[model samples]
Target: MTRKPTSSDHIVDEKFEPWERNGRMPLPVVWVAVALAIWGTGTLLTTSGGAPETAVEAAVQQDRPVDAPDSGAALFAANCATCHQPNGSGVRLAVPPLRGSEFPAQGPELVANVLLRGIDGPIRVDGHDYDGHMPSFSAAFGDAEIAELASYVAATFGDRDDGVDTATVADLRARAVGQGTWSGGEALAAAYPGLPPQPAFSSASVTPVSADVSALIFEGRDDVWACASCHGDLGQGVENTPRLSGLSADYIAKQLRDFQTGTRANEHMSFVAKGLTEADIAGLGAYYAGLSVPSTAAPILGGDLKRGETLALVGDWDLGVPACFSCHGPSGFGVAPNFPALSAQQAPYTASQLAAWAGGHRANSPLSLMDQISKGLSTDDRRAVADYLASLPAVPAGSTGAVAKEGDGHDL
Candidate 1:
């Protein structure tokens, strides 16, 4: 059988031989390519108009609920509730109460104006004066959202049944283009003269105190003397004592703690601080932080008023002193969580503290910045700047003070 090889054996099927002998693609590969082509073509045809949604788009769609867009209460709780409070009875002296306020009740237009543009300066609400800034909502909220917020505020606080309309909000927003914040009450009054007459200033109208403040400060707790005895009923301190109203809660608490630890030396305050518990310090801080009073501080020291103004507004670069406003905020309203407001602070207290810093008697200033700053100032210079600060408004009209910079030493 092996005697001779036949030619028939050598001559194989032409197509099969070529494919098998040569390194060509396998049948499975060809089939896979064809299947993939078919699937890609089908997918293209099915979604010819657009590509599939991105992960971010899908996530956004899933995250937002339908009702969230229209819910005024939800928006308020997210945005306005922090300062104005949940019940709309805003913090006294710090924020104006909306519950019984006539401003919102007048019309949606007035509220829209405020919401869109914001308002600033010393405003007399009820009988109390509030020197603070209301920020603009134009950038934060859309027309529809603004309308919803206005409606809610009107209905809930202003007692208005009809809420504001989106169209009206849009129109007002359009008109507010290129305009700044409303200056003050006078400016708002000029715009719409039909506002309710402000009641006469009443000393009796005091900020509502918490139970803790009442037990400890208003009424003496155990051996501790009543805080109101030295600091006035409204936390507006008498002669030689520092004004406590509108000071940052953290600053107040820190000072008390410092006093207790003998880090800050004051005969009366040291004794008082020793008796205070941690809870007492916190309560006292919060209570005073909520209280705001009009500044009646005047320059008793015979410092040059113009020179004082110059020093406060822009510091003496020749002497290497920084502007008071640079750290304390433009109008000395104080930066939150740290800096204490100096605009309405008593002149004596400010001067004494400055002197203390210069003499190394007080060592609790942030980074010892006050220590270095005070060292540059002479006794008369200290008095001059202190007087100027006392004379300035806590939150000046149209000034950029409330918008604080991140992580800076604030003025006390």
Candidate 2:
């Protein structure tokens, strides 16, 4: 009877682990772990090239006072490393090397001067010549900070200790008066004969480019960004860059202000706009406003301009969308004041902006007209109008009216 009643007698162990059946993990678990480890190793190998250092890390390193502290390593990586390179090997015929070079060893005085004034023209370093321009750090860095940078360059690259003290830098700053960029290395070479003999590099000397303020628009806002990288020079819109030139100054100003204020939600434009000052904004407006509209490349976006023209001239009122020209003006040149010029816009840029408006990503357009118009159009309609706009002559022979003027409500 007892043997026959044992159907429900098999109790499972509460603390049992299938993986610990033996003394170690099961073979399958081990295999899974090995696969994970291999994957992790591969990930690390692939991700060895992000940033040399971040700004937060550089700021943190500045806690020390006396010499170039352990923090200078981060500071140097942030600033000097771009041209002289992280290891100070530098770039050929562009920038001179600091590694094993006599430049950094010529005492902190010379280094401080160069830092304050900026050096240009042919310079020899490690038996090579670099004819590149070095922008002045005087406007950017303070005495203690520049000293720390110089100290780091000498110790880390020149392999020397105790280059420039902060006090010495302050003293030099006091003596430093009017600003003029250094012309060549002749004066430096004559002054510091004890410096190491550097071999001259044989390469074409780089021509100087205008870098005052306008260059920032084309070159970079800082080392990490450039408007020209997206928008072409003269504000000709690139692939997805909106045409910036010939827009009403007020329109451009408002857009930049919106971008800065987070009223606009573009990651790229906002980032660049954040660093621009009010004065900078005004100057840029003037610069671009003065330029005549430049022609862009042919439309790569395939759309029927004829169909697009219909959308531009007369909208489908059946769908409650207004003619594109109704607000843009008869010539699509934009009414001066708030509206932007649409003539000769890039097709891709036009389409993208329209799409952004429709999706509610761009709500900064005047009167919410763009949002309404974009949402009403089908994708094909959007493409058609964008292509049609791109085909218009940027600057018509008889039309010099790219700037918008304040007036409204003459529906054609």
Candidate 3:
């Protein structure tokens, strides 16, 4: 008596409504279908276990800081690859190629400007038109991060061996504080068409006390020995001593300051610098910088000329050494107030300095760059490089040295 089998129980009323009377999908079911579609599209950021992740949660999962881009490559991959492409080939007619572009070769400033200020509207690169918008990176990156990004770009695609430094980028940042995105390539080119500004001290501090300075160099003061006692009357230096002529004022001032503060330790130099006032230091710097370096210094050592030449021109990277010219400047003329003229320096003096650096005795160089490099050099290698450096003539023969005057200290 199980409610006797009835045919009516198996059939539903055709006229009666189930849940809704309307012949449409239910709203709840529609919402669920939309959610499933969204999941299928793969827009969800997820963990390895396939759990959904929010922005902060994703950072936590990856163990990366919320704001940090991780690395230069990561920064470029995230921010630049869309239009620039992963390799920096860029989109034809829409974007520009970074590789072989004359812009990167021009200098760091142009490249830095574009990155910080973005480019809007049209710009031509390598004779091709790039008409897309490049978003500003100023807000998203710090100077150091930007420098790294620029360096990565330069190294990877632009064929620039010397990478951009943070100080340069920071300088750029200071200049670009209030500037907006670039209007056009032509305008930008017009504005900064010349050389980027040089950072060293370009002017002398006090009036050129040429005769007084010359007297100071030739005659000993109460506290100091006569410079000429060790150096030549012209400050050209005796055997094994360093010549003070043709060096940058900034370089000379910094050296004297370093000696005075014990940042650069030399018994003689420490005493000499300690006896001089800041004005005296600046006056001496101007006097020396005004004089031209002699074309040649008498050799105080001998080495394999061929090996020394190779080291000066192109360094042996296997030995963890860079060429002398790379940092010293092209043709060893000098790179302003930092690396002085290696050419025409006394071989013995150069060798002694290198030895000092190797033995951890001197440590005043920026970033200790020289100290690290010297430590890696062999004794023979040092001697060879020093000899080659002393062989070069700073200028043509028949040129005379500086002539002390009343006030004006012009190049002689």
Best by lDDT: 1
Judged by TM-score, which candidate is best?
1
Candidate 3 residues 1-412, lDDT tens each? 5768799877878787775656889799999999998886565443333545455575654422223454667777755663466777764443567776666766555677778887554456676654434556787687767876776676667666666676787788888878876765655666667423222221221234567676678786787877778866545665578877666676678888999999888899899989988878888887776554333375557776557778887788998878886666544545555667666677888888889888988878876777867877788888888887776544111111111112222110
lDDT per residue for candidate 2 within 1-412, as digits (tens), equals: 4566575556657897776656866799999999999998766555644333544466566545746346567767655653466778764443467877787877666777778776654567776654534656776677777787777777776667767877787776766667466655654676578765433333332122335445677677564366667777667777777777656555677778988999888888888889888877776665565454335734568887667877777788997887776677654666655666676778888888888888888886546777877889888888888887776545321122333345642210
Off by over 4 Å in 1: 1-205, 395-402, 408-411
Worst 10 residues of 1 by lDDT: 394-403
Candidate scoring better on lDDT of 1 and 3: 1
Stretches of candidate 2 off by over 4 Å are 1-212, 396-412
User: Model 1: per-residue lDDT, tens digit, 249-363?
Assistant: 7778999998899888888889888999898898888778766455556777777766776677679988888878667654566766566677767788888988988898888
For model 3, the local distance difference test gives: 0.65
Position 111, candidate 3: lDDT: 71
Extract clashing residue pairs from model 1: none
Count of clashing pairs, candidate 3: 2
The models' CA-based lDDT, in order, is 0.72, 0.66, 0.65
Which is the winner by lDDT between candidate 2 and candidate 3? 2
Evaluated at residue 108, the lDDT of candidate 2 is 62
Per-prediction CA RMSD (Å): 20.6, 21.0, 24.6
TM-score of each model, paired residue for residue:
0.52, 0.46, 0.46
Candidate 1 overall Cα lDDT vs. reference? 0.72
